[model samples]
Target: YGAAEAGRDYNTTDMSRQRMYNEYLPPYKAAVEAGVGSVMSSFNDINGIPATANKWLMTDLLRKQWNFLGFVATDYTAINELSAHGLGDDKKVSELALNAGIDMDMVGEIFLRNLAQNIKEGTVKQADVDQACRRVLEAKYRLGLFQDPYHGVSEARAKQVLMQPAFVQAARDVARRSLVLLKNDNQTLPLKNTANIAVIGPLADRPLDMLGNWSGAGDAKQAVSILQGIKNVGGATIRVTYAHGANVTEDAQLIARLNEHGGQLDIDPRPADAQIAEAVAAAQKAEVVVAVVGESQGMTGEAASRADIGLPGRQLDLLKALKATGKPLVVVLC
Candidate 1:
């Protein structure tokens, strides 16, 4: 729920606000109403306010107005976010979180460690502590965890529910509904069957990164790559040539981290000159150069905020080289 970047893909403030109200809020409200026990808020500061301790999201949205009786948990160590989130120091953050009605402090023992001192110092009201603890106890009572703590999950069930086909199909349905066709220019309609088609780009050939960021439920193995899609669109006679024009990122830190995680995008962190030369050569020979350009999977997701989101490294240089080749350039902006 961070603010949309200025002048980028989803940069408008009004668009961002609309997403919060129309997209993210309703499901949460529904979950609370379905007799759900509790909700754990986020670690990242949303709209410059930590969701864990935001008065608007926690007090106004969940408690006072929604009348949610369920307990609220903080995302791991999010209670001590005062120091990291620029709220204040650890002590102030603890007080803020407790007062904000967070019941459980995950990972960070801020409340257990400092609630007493905060009460003595008049930074936190004792009534706030009682209310939070009461909510937690109420949740435990509702779950019957006190009488039967380990009743729901079992090893047999865990193995059997590796992946329920019904669940997978439901997810696919949601994805299909959310799908937006970016371009469908006149009678480019269903692209007539052609024997010669160029499947050229960094992503066109790489299936792994096609799933994009935070693909937790997405089956990477099952998801078809662009190359697979093109092949599926035609028969054996259709010819396809793939060229890895440029890497996903040129940042040294990002490349090192990606390499550490066994990522394919950071294949070779050599100078941009070598990759550009190779792409230029391939583009020069082909009838069309479908150049792929953009950040890596983790580049724009969590902790991936950027002061400048301009094309990474010498990709522009590579594109310029490819353009000089005079082939029909069909850039795939990822």
Candidate 2:
């Protein structure tokens, strides 16, 4: 992505060719030379041109200059999205992408739909289409897909390996290692064995949410929600209480938009003040409070661009109420 924000897809990057050649192109050059099988054209523009439809990027730099032998695939409907970037409509994008040396489409079948007709109309060259086909075929050959289309397919193997004890332990270790400590004033962490803690937030007990956006074929019920996780780690050594602080948002528009993509963040039917009072009561009883709240997994990832990045809805209000409680507070932005 070139100078892109989550809110906007297209943005130009001002750069010098010297800096681009030296700083940016080396890793890609290395990957090509290392015989990587494929390259994915990103969903952002470079120098006011969308990468999927930029001939200089997909063809000139990647293939002619760098001599990359592998095929180039568009990043998820990026080819079809050229119009959104002010490039053109579907047929126009298909032609532009093909001419730019894009070999495969991810989900958007613009290439499949328009390439042959465009070639017949002399808008797209047959040679370009042939080259793209050849590159993709060569990649498949390298992967032995022709020899065995079912090479790695396994149903029983999945059950055998998924949630395996060793794998689970490894995942836990990785998660532990990945945690970044932002601030720990006065050594506030390493909670006292006898600490009374209140865990409050919409995400605190959301088991399904604990398993992020890409938990393929995995059961979210097995996921450890923040409240459960705190209890598990604290054990009988510490006392813990929980409250459903507030739903992710009260804004009807956001709720509607999220639900459009099956991003369901339930608007808690309970009155907002009542919810806050409950959370406040929990906070008042505890020596420390852990507030787990923020973007649901849906408010992130593709197509979920947020212009306002702060705590959405009345989340800040909840935080303010918690702050007034004056307990040692730990905020986890999930």
Question: Top TM-score: which candidate number?
Answer: 2
User: Where in model 1 is the C-alpha error above 4 Å?
Assistant: 2-62, 85-88, 116-130, 140-180, 184-191, 217-223, 232-235, 260-264, 269-291, 316-331
**Local accuracy of candidate 1 as per-residue lDDT tens digits, 56-103:** 878888988788888898876778765776788778888888877788
- Each prediction's RMSD over C-alphas, in Å, is 5.3, 2.4
lDDT of each: 0.71, 0.83
TM, every model: 0.69, 0.90
Candidate 2 per-residue lDDT over residues 1-334, each given as its tens digit: 5436434644455456787788877888899999888999988777778888889988899889988888999999889889888777788888888888899998999988888889888999888888889988987888888999777778988888888999999998997798888998767686775479999998888777776766666576677888898989888888899988888888887788778866656677888888999999999999999999888777766555677889876778888999998888888877
TM-score for predicted model 1 compared with the true structure = 0.69
| Candidate 2 wrongly placed segments (more than 4 Å) | 5-14, 213-219, 236-238
In angstroms, how far off is 29's CA in candidate 2? Answer: 2.0
* lDDT, candidate 2, at 61: 91
